[model samples]
Target: MGSGSAKTYRLAFNGTAGQYFGIWATNVALTILTLGIWSAWAKVRTKRYFLGNTTLD
Candidate 1:
């Protein structure tokens, strides 16, 4: 491949069910406690979690 050529990276998900469930459970609890006001924050948190666990290599 030429130096100027586009490179490809593999996308991998390293998040485990147990780890995700913990985050989800916390988000759910907080959302309920805040009367759904925490849903937006929960969404951001979930997205960040997923992104953080994903790898590009």
Candidate 2:
């Protein structure tokens, strides 16, 4: 009976899987090149990338 009064929400992904893969690959390469020293920065970047692209409605 209240169906018409219900609100609808949508969630979306602003980032593509390919883009994430590229970023992941690059980070892995750089981390290895630096002998794992770049891992910390890579982790931060990876987390930021996902968080930035995630959206709620």
lDDT against the true structure, per candidate, is: 0.95, 0.92
Off by over 4 Å in 2: 1-10
Among these predictions, the greatest lDDT belongs to 1
Q: Please list all clashing residue pairs in model 1, or write none if there are none.
A: none
lDDT by residue (tens digit), candidate 2, 3-24: 5777788887799989999999
Q: Write the per-residue lDDT of candidate 1 for residues 1-57, one digit (tens) a residue.
A: 567968799999999999899989999999999999999999999999999999999
Looking at model 2, which ten-residue stretch has the lowest summed lDDT?
1-10
Q: Residue 43 CA error for candidate 1 (Å)?
A: 0.6
Give the best candidate by TM-score.
1
- Screening candidate 2 with a backbone cut-off below 3 angstroms (N, C-alpha, C), the clashing residue pairs are none
